[model samples]
Target: MGDGHSQVAQKDKYVAIIDQDKVTDEVRNIALRYDPLNRAGRREGFHVTENGELHIDDEAVIEEHKIVANRIPNDAIKIVRLPAERGELVHQYGENGFRLYELPAPVKGTVGLLGRNGIGKSTALRILGGTLKPNLGAVSDEPDWDTVIREFRGTAVQNYLEKLRDGGVSTAYKPQQVDRIPDRYDGTVRELLIVRDERNLRDKAIERLNLEHIADAFVDDISGGELQRVAIAATLVADVDAYLLDEPSSYLDVGQRLSVARTLEEFVEDKMVLVVDHDLVTLDVVSDDFHAFFGDPAGFGVVSRPLSARRGINQFLEGNLRDENVRIRDTPIDFLRPSARQEMDGIPILEFPALTKKFQSFSLGVESGTIFGKEILGIFGRNGLGKTTFAKLLAGALEPDEGRVDADINISYKPQYLDSSFDGTVVELFAGQVDVYTRAFETEIQQPFDLEPLFDLVVGELSGGELQRVSIALALARDADIYLLDEPSAYLDVEQRMSFAATLRQFVNRNGAPCLIIDHDLLLLDYVSDRAMVFEGESGVSGVGRSPQSVRKGINRFLKIVDVTFRKDPNTGRPRANKPGSQKDREQKASGNYYAV
Candidate 1:
């Protein structure tokens, strides 16, 4: 009896330890099941020893691993482990190559594929969708589209389809480029739904995405955020068993992003969804399982424990934030004046006069020269405000129905969708048209901005944050007297955003070049801008001018009013403050938090 009780206690202790480890034994089994070698060795349980030493054992517990691996035909498994060097060429770019290995069987429910940019996230999605083939990997049990349709044609087909259609595994894919929608679709929102056989699912998607008003507008004419939602709507209407979405929240506002998160919850209840995105914030809200891939010569590959399920997903998010490759920091441009009034009496670089654009129920004045050389002008507004529209008009891409735009000096505008403007390699842009600026800002652009290796890489293929950095580099390389940027730090992580703010300040100081930027990144706005214009009131959109000091006050007041929670550093219990430029000064002021406003 004593020996039996001891054995029971030991067993209970093992279970207790596994439970304390956070990930369950079931999850470990699932991960190991994908690799048959693990199962064959009887190494399938949560722990190798009683203490849980050699491995944490959580990798095997992924819920979808069992379902996906089970679905994969035996032929696919045979091909997955083929020699990497001998595989058929799947995709080839300058230094990037991709070869498909055996397709992992589709998982039972939604699955998320995560990784940094340049890791073939999109390429993998394409392979799964049958739009692209793997160069070196073998594909077995490839589902035939014609067979699916023909096999399910009649009553006889329905009976035969039971095994295939157990739960209806449909697929909807949203590409990375939001601007890639066909230029000639003459269908209304309702019409597009019908075309996609998603008319019934349209209302739910629309309500979740907040797209009731622009249902009838042309796809090309809507705002970037609206367009993204519409694309989601089109995908949702398909009611696929799984979804392949690439940066689905790229242009959405904060509120809209949260809404999309909720919608994803409803959409993926019993389906498999793979998403490729750089927005860690949005991904955190939606992901069930995480698979991270890193770029390599052969192809992008997965990281088993991308993040610890025990420590939770926040650690993974921080890892992404700290990755230097995806972060961008613009050189600080230092202007002579400390205030907006201290401008040199020269030709106004750019001007907006009585510029009013009205869509449905909103209007704003796109005012002029309030912007001067080397000055950082910050434009502030609410989510639905015309800040983005104002940026488009200033860039000369959108024609304002009510006002005229005049440029006294050369101007370069960085649109909100910075990726769309990039058509060539980074090196081509530097040496081709903007060579002189690159030579002038050689030290800053090369070292601080870090555009060296990216010179050979295609700009269109870069991640969102990476593209933003490239856009800043391209703009700084230009000789234009005035620079216009819209949400320059939208996609950047905390560190990159700080560096970008400093860089903008440095640039303003060196050349006294004028810059106007519209953004919701308040910390950046406060750090760089000498003057700010707050867009308030009804249709008139009054510009309440404020000094940097006063602007800080306004921001603090607004934050208090809104009750937004600021993130605190895990290492240091205090609220995380922006890094100070001078280490000595930062040390001196380390005792207290720097409160703006």
Candidate 2:
């Protein structure tokens, strides 16, 4: 008992007892005594060092417990481990020479990065794209491959770097800011795609993405959804060994997103693909595996090792990293039941009578609909389907050619694409509404969306995700009877979208304010809506907005028209897009139960 070897013998005795399946309290206590480090971190296993030092088997936690790698290869490469940092910090603690994050290399199949806004998913993608060579804790200069490779050696990343260093891997990256696509290109969609057609897959990509109709449309004249598809097509048609797509699902409807994902899946068969996405359901379907980016937004990020898509998403939702033994969030996110069980009998808060609007290039017809108090109405359709037009009409931002919206109730509208004309900070945008900075609003909006740290940033300088959150929060802060949010889920990562959806739902229920949410992510709609309004018609030409119906009915009708079906996932109860021509798709279509659960 006096010597280390004697203590090791005592530990061995308990190990023998545990091995024999007699895990009594005394034996467990003995195991913990000799293996305190491992016991503290143990979820289901043990890590014993050569010198009989027992520690957590997790690479990230072990790395944290020890000194940073001094000589690169000689010390272990902290790969496949997630972060243990808290979600928010007043300032970035990693600016002076330390890494805000270290990510594991992507595996062969399609890999994904999942986290909230400002979490450095884009940064990780840039690193993988070879645009930003990692400094690897070197402050003065970007580390050369020799230094990088030596540090990354003994991991899959070492081989990736080797291939990159040798020019064996060619990368084509579709950036996150597709909104800027217009600034660089001044041509029709077809012209752009043709120019990017290095692989001669223009025709095939166009057909797969259903871009034939918009082929002749000008790049600058197109909507966000159109730009998103074109960006994907351009990236896909480029000949490359590695493909990096950031937020491919943004502005895409469920069907278009699935099509894009399917194409990427097919193309990745013999290639390396990395995707960063915010929609959990779409990310689940598109990615074979995922690496979670965890930490403060724009502060620092650490990526986890590759996990099966399902586990990665679930872990993100639970805010727990089993391997790293850390909880990034204070509470776990829970998926609601498949259906809304309670019926609202409250009086109508707002009603817009049948409305018709005519445009130079398009026309819209919106059927009369009523929103009851405490209701969340989801609007689902393809892009440019007049959903936004209808919301504008109701908000008095636009006038209907025919009927009129109720003038009694006040409406707060968050536009689909946020334009920052404001010359002040986010906090200033809410100067008159001081409650937004208060603790009461923090629990509902600021905290969940991680907006406090971003309060001082100029409105125009905010990132896409930050802008989207601020826009939604601003709309919510207004004293109005109803909130009209167009694509509120845009730019949000999986966690942010889930958190925002919960926040919106809570806001509506608690404040007795009805909300009309128009978004392309069917999963978000399903999660948030009490009823849904389906928009149908030709894109960029005309659209017909049907009256709001029960969430299930409206979604079913929309899915049926899109020729895709959704089934509830057994694990999470969230809607999942069935593969085209799969048995579920066929059965659901044949049974006339699209979106049936």
Candidate 3:
């Protein structure tokens, strides 16, 4: 109190929480008690003193309130001790960042790792797979698994590691980046899978992964999705006691994703399996239980105990671990009711006539539609249904065979295929494209998109999620009448997707610009879209894109095509895919409400 003045009688402990934005009279008095010379005649707008004093300057620009760093002496502040941990694997990064991965010693069945990206999921997987040995929180010359096992002496993970050390257990791992397979192996799909086919299940694995069409294709020539499937199939064909898969649904479609999940469950039902994925729905469907990872992304993390599939997802959405009494995230992710008011009756910004485009073996036709002002149009369909083709047509990258978008509009588009070939850093990229230093850009684009941390990093070196955030931020930074984002949710985690959806919706409302987002994330579409567009018909051969309609109706139509019914969770309002013949599913199907509220 009184700016730490000893004359005012210094106490052993004191804490004063001040509102940084609106400095109160009492707070100003406290500041003056320390520095009586602090005054108001500093500049245009406000004078923010280095000593945490605020002065009224009419011509000064008001700075946004930020969290102030603690600068008191070490003896002045009390330290809150964290609970002690005796985990199987403990890895440290920098001085304070580390991961306390607490897993069952001898992992059983299929347990999943759920969390935001860069929070130590991959590290945990690698440590378990014997690729990276655990150090047990030490910086010694040799980090040994023996010490790690000793730390978990009375734990199941210790037993698991002991068996592994004795060569009694084996493991097969599938890394997150499937494209890297081409870097290590130049062989064909069949060759890759058969090499790891110690169980003689290569043929079944290929069939299950839908690799029959590209069975003989070289790894270098196949698509991203194809590479992912091949990688999974290769690992599945191995005769290992445990399997570790990271982001198995990265580039897959709905049907392909389901098929892969089913195959994984069937092949490794009796073995120990651990998966790390961001798609909540797919994770819910595939995993029997979950180990939720919590803490600062890319900095520190703690893996929690096992939670049932349904409970895990719901708790993640709620941003809290009920059992541990730990809050992983700031706010709960809750969705507004479908019947809530949205920008439904806004004026039309762009009108398109029935459009058609044809390629060598595929053709796409879209029914006429109008995108309302300040509204987001959600596009849903499986892969190869010409979604990208449709986007390019609207972007004027391709000519329609029949009709056209017809409207004269400036568009900001983030394409499905991102070219990470930039030779400059993220800061330089933003400098050459948008004014990243401005307040508006910092608030609306940089902060919400979490692009600040990647500013100094080279564009080409960024990961999938990092690259995606950059591409999307660039798109949003530009001045355009219409925003076209194809699969914007592709590489983003669940939290990132929801954050972007909220930001995009706010941007639309503020700028009065309509946006069309084509993505496969149902919860994202449900959260961001004011209306929806359903694309149907045969994949890769013939496709149809229907006109935009109400969000409920459009989603219902699309889900009907997929033959899956979704109902909102009562607690969080997030979509939960119903069981095949569950009461909710049966009721929704009978009532013809696939996207039930």
Candidate 4:
């Protein structure tokens, strides 16, 4: 067996060398296609060996080929590693808590710390940022944070400055929650640019990020997604070597997410950028390295391959299931059942008659049978489309100017901006409201959704998924006949999104309630929704309603323009598209965009 293994290893080495030669030849051919002037230079080094192999020694080509060999270890930076301790209290009630179990050397470039709700990912980040100190674990390198900083000031002063100047190391943290700007101090987005010492570079940053429209808007009233972008903009304006962004894409939609990923890629070209996000799709595209924090006391974490990031995250959330390979199911979901349609009583819960929404120049109509009990409705459109506006109109937050909105039934609306809407603990949001629906549903809400541990926890401290669950609980706790959930599953991870869908299904099945969910996650939409609405056109006002299968077909047809193919998810059976080639395959797979049929 050892001999056979040795032979296989030898063969693998030869194959690798052969592959490298092939790649070199391909690179030369492609370079020659565009740079005709370099042909003579390339010919100087071009040769065919006795084995009939092409070789090139062009200086530029050789330099380009040396990129892999020239790669520097980014993990060389001296990180203050902490020794792992048992059950150390990182936080003592109300304050942020973290306990480091194994402080792996900073070999992985820009580690991403991901975990389930309340698992202390944010707390761990704060500890690394020097904002919070773990009560239990000690730094592996003798001196504590203060001592390290002082030591840097004392002996390593020149080295630290040199590192900073050479862009060898720097770290900045952007919190998941946006803090309130001082009311007395009014400032435009451009003014906030000055805070980061980018007053002169404001236009460059804005143009790069495409934030011209909201450049003058007050920092206070921008949309949640826009606010998130602004926060990122503030960080990008600063010249840093590393950035720790917590849930940067929490409020962004599909388009904005793509834009943000592009921006981060540019940023990471010269510096390490660690973005802790719940959206697996964005992470797959943006991250070069991935890390996950799991287990009790939340100390255990594993640095995983980038390709397996999504699977690792899912496994962490759901536990190691038997079918590990099948991460997502692609089965088409039935949003509404026959029984649900029969129980509608012929009265429309809410109808938008030629609903022409403001800010978005489009119109549509929704009838009674269109949305039935316990049905998940996916409202999809391009960004700047009136999806949010339409949601606001349904929620009674905005009055329609032209069309009649017949929301004759009791409705509970969970808006997109959950942070500003509610203030208090998770318990407080549903405490008084739970009893009101208990008698109606004939089942105690607390029993179905366990609100005990979450009673005292502040709402503001909750993760996006936790807050989303809380929002759903609060909405479900109410005795409303209809639910208008705007981007209900926006910030939730794969597990949370699925769990929320099940909860929504239960709400409809148990209490005969209906819901309209505006979301960008097509997979979730396929699973939970009974009907799909696709809003098209540049303004995204007009929409076409169709079945899940039909919608998949339409999406596939549209995505074909980009040379991508949509396939059924093996786990859930939802439709998903993927780009051609292994690079795009790895990216799409890592992103968790693979849908179920």
Candidate 5:
């Protein structure tokens, strides 16, 4: 969009551009002649014959681009690129930006935007939703529609933009913060949803999302998960050309996340759909192709060209962008297997008998479990299944109705939701906390979380991810035999979640302190725990936590109940959710093995 005239000169070196409409027959023939299934090394040269036939010596490059192009459905509307400038801030509100990347919108399958937070993903989606007109690098002046149309001429996006500029297209956007919906609306969920039902899809959406019971409930009374479903339902009911959802997986359990993905893939097949999610497994399951965002968060954001889902995600985990010739991270994030459980020769750090906690309409029964000095226990359960209730009982924040935690042992607890009530900077809040300032903690917590730059920021003004990191550090820095962290990975991006998991494992192993972590992220749990506890029962009415078992056993038990299965990715060995009713899912279910091998 910057000055039009094919400003892709900088990226031309690594990228091979071919106009699909203008390509010669010979060029097309050569591309089709190559065996798509061949696995041979490709050469590296670009050549053009005198007859205007284009050729690339590198078969791998041709194959890669071919796969991407092939994946784009024949009915794709347009390819969009949002570029960012680096080296200096564009204005008082902008930072150095990343380079140009492309987002192709297919009329059918979803195209995911994956990256760390604050990488202009939301901005791009806003442009697509028509909520924000892209300045297209001309922030100082008004957007020029004529130049923008000319730049993307001969593509589906050009015609789309022309219609958009002329007020012909409509879009429905589900924003990232579903938790904030209550603040903007005051009505029953049904009322809020039905009012937006231009397409008469309210009933269908509600049934698909399992929101029948809460249809008449006030928006203010619903939980975060409920709010998310309601928000998605509203988006679905609206008649729009594009359906954009930002972080639909947040506040949802693994099962619910899958449900949402299925609903979108089923009902929104004919329309353009775009989604942004940090849960790697969810993103992989929901998207056909992905556009990866890379660059310094809050500094500069760059979008990568589209690639097949598996390849793009693998590249992201590898921290390398081969086509862009950039390494976004210092090192690749590995999904390494957890170490074997340590033989606990020492005495148990804490042991609790069967515990019961009852609230107004909810009750939790925790089966007896023991934690050794060298063990970290992971808690897996759906929302309202009393995982947090068990954690609170362990931390003495709540007294169990009928059982007791060891009164003599010390425990530190980080709650599920964070509170930013501190009236000073982050450093000031931890001024006398010696461990936080020590070299060991700095290396383990500060460096990995990138907290050094956030130390001077006001505690009340910190972002969700920042506050989570601070809360984790505070809990770890305290002198305690056991730690209880509830939803510590909430709001953290994939990179931060991976880093935090590593840090937590190191702290638990190094200090020989036991930890009980309750979270919904399966990947983080797999990476950090030696054993897991599965909670089962009615979500709100009653929940029963089973005794701690091996990680695989617990995961298998839980996933079996939820009717889902995981398979290991051949490239990264990461856990990936199998499509429901797929061959792998059927095979695993038949064999009574839900966890990946």
Candidate 6:
């Protein structure tokens, strides 16, 4: 009873609202069944393939029956769109079958992008920063900015692109992988940062980012944490209209992360900044709003509309977009409450007395502590506060000047720095010591760690995240009495990190082997640890490691040193840092309860 011009959908809701100028042929063709006009005229003898490619059985034969049986019902459009709400199409980019659906261009303040690795977060940032041109989902043809701006007419992003095209805007991008900066630029940190000082704020940048200690050090000789800060400082000194910072807090400890956040808050006085980070607590602190991403990793991504940082983080944790009426995940990711964790049931497996380690300029002293079997003890402090040194001492990789670990224990350690010098493949790397084909390894390490695809890849050819996964899996697979992981979550995506946490919890429960994790990510520590071993003292001068204690007390000890308080999200049980000077922060500090309910 209808013509081929329009189609009405739903019992009460009429959703035939596609504007002609905005729809690309590629996108339109993919959802052609939903278009009444296309549906009526598409009775030709052709078969639409799954990848939307057209194939002819024979050049001379035309069979209308071929099209009859190869049709997708119009209702499947719901599944194609998934969780992305159709509001406005600002930008589209595609490459190698991966598409960045809708991306929002920021004008002012900080906008945080949160999602899994290999999604379109970095691609979106590159496109917005003008480092990469968008193909409008049409990668076969050359990109045309006029067409792009025309298609986005009357939208907020249209004017932004026009400004960019006219050189009315400028951008500075801090890449996600700061470890590669040395390959691109070398020399002293001060020398490199001084040249990037478009605003002549070199010293100011160093002071603000806490790069004063490494200012004169060679870029290639500095630590990962130092490289991260130096990258931020380089961007900070640049005089640009917009700042795109990717993973600014990756290698930083909790104190350094908070300091970096405060620096970012001050730097965004009147400029726009877009940040991509996996640390939820730091992201929450630095961002005023968020653009939550939902998609299959490495396949495609769809970004939601602008949302308040609070609401965005909560909805992402809940795995649903209420406004879009879509489920991004099959189930919500829950953070276990302190009460939900298993009690400390038995005696400590590894015991150590007061120990001291002395370096040329820095020294560390530790009080007596014991790590309980089947319990995860989290080591926390600033970057240079001897967390890694302590782990090395415990693993017997380094000698202590004074006391020692009381009992002999077999230790399997994943160091803070991952070595990519192995000449053989990942399978060959673990060929003899551990079996990678066992059922236990499959469930605990292979599947959760996403290592199946990495079996054939040479160890030296792996990226940071891939190498981290391989290192973590190899360390966990070995037969040892204790597992010590240093910054194991580094370079992992949000989902990967969560999966690793869950796997560790399960591994401990099944094997009864304890893990001592040294990390800077407060959220990860809070999520995975049952006991806390807090390290405190002056950054490079001296460090003191307190005895292992309850998770609440350990968190409180570190939070007090950082001069902040955290409250668990009521819905997800995830810890969220309270804003400094906020009423909640003041209340927690007054009550001496730095880790609030």
Best by lDDT: 6
Please report the TM-score between candidate 3 and the true structure: 0.82
Once fitted onto the true fold, the runs of candidate 1 whose alpha carbons sit more than 4 angstroms away are 1-114, 130-168, 182-186, 197-199, 295-301, 306-313, 317-361, 365-383, 392-410, 417-433, 436-438, 441-470, 487-506, 519-597
Backbone clash numbers for all candidates listed = 46, 3, 7, 29, 3, 0
Candidate that beats the other on lDDT, 2 or 3, i.e. the better one: 3
TM-scores for every candidate against the unseen true structure: 0.58, 0.79, 0.82, 0.65, 0.79, 0.83
Q: Which ten residues in a row have the lowest lDDT in candidate 1?
A: 8-17
Q: What is the lDDT of residue 447 in candidate 4?
A: 44
Model 2 per-residue lDDT at 100: 39
lDDT of 5 at 531: 85
C-alpha lDDT of candidate 4 relative to the true structure: 0.51
lDDT of 1 by residue, 518-562 (tens): 776554566667667655443223322232234545454433332
Query: Alpha-carbon error at 17 in model 2, in Å?
Result: 45
lDDT for 43 in candidate 2 is 52
lDDT of each: 0.52, 0.72, 0.73, 0.51, 0.74, 0.75
Error of 6 at 110 (Å): 0.8
lDDT of 3 by residue, 1-597 (tens): 012211212222111222343355444554333321234442332234676655432111122211111322111111111233312336754222344445533367788788888777888887788766666556435556676666665555767778777788889998876766787899999988878899899999988887887898899877677888898998998998999998888767666777887898788868999888988778888888788887656545678777888888889878888887767777886644442437578888888899998887788989998888898888988766788788888888888999967558888889876667789999999899878779999888888887866887899888878988999999989989889998788767777887788898889889898989988777778777888888899765789999888777877887888778888777676677787789989999999999776
Q: Give the backbone clash total of model 4.
A: 29
Which is better, 3 or 6, measured by TM-score?
A: 6
Ranking by lDDT: 6, 5, 3, 2, 1, 4
TM-score of predicted model 2?
0.79
Order the numbered candidates by TM-score, best leading: 6, 3, 5, 2, 4, 1
- Model 5: lDDT to the true structure: 0.74
lDDT of 2: 0.72
User: What value of lDDT does candidate 6 attain over all alpha carbons?
Assistant: 0.75
